[model samples]
Target: MRKTKWFTFRNFFHRSSLTSSMKPRPVNAYSFVPFSPVAMLDPTILTIGGVVLGIAIIERILERWGVIDLVDQFSKVMRFILPVTFYGALFYFFATFMF
Candidate 1:
């Protein structure tokens, strides 16, 4: 039996609403981990994450194609620490200033 477009959409949304309401039940051993913010809210973050992931991926592809290699094979632990701290501070600053 063929379903009407409206019935199909209604069924989809109804199923989504049911799923969204289900509590954070553990699906596996480590399933107690909190839900990611990106999963619970606006798709904007997901879209931005997709773009950032794409750029990072393309950068890798370009590096493979003989462009300047930005990533190091052996980076010091501090390499990640510094930029993350800087970005965290910058994000806080902007969040405070703008909001």
Candidate 2:
């Protein structure tokens, strides 16, 4: 007598009901609107102004403590240098890539 393949395979494994018990659930819609990149100036200006104000405050505090004179000199140089450097870089980047 020959043994069948189904009987041989059935002896090797046991079945479980755990897999059929679980079901996927749907996600709810988002409650808030997405951000727009076009109106960037308002936030950018506010952020730059806040950062400059904070740096000025910190420099004043450091000056009061009589720390190194480097901060004052660097600030003086940066006052003239930063805007020029920023605009130059901006123009170069845009002119090279955009136009």
Tens-place lDDT per residue, model 1, 1-99, is 955444477677566453353468766566565545444244544455565566567667766876553444313433675477557655654454421
lDDT tens per residue, model 2, 17-75: 35653478898888464554443345544466566667777778877788758677858
Choose the strongest candidate by TM-score.
2
TM-score of 2: 0.36
All candidates: CA RMSD (Å): 19.8, 14.5
lDDT agreement with native, every candidate: 0.53, 0.62
Q: Which stretches of candidate 1 lie over 4 Å from their true place?
A: 1-41, 69-99
Clashing residue pairs, backbone N/CA/C < 3 A, model 2: none
Give every collision pair in model 1.
none
TM values, all candidates: 0.32, 0.36
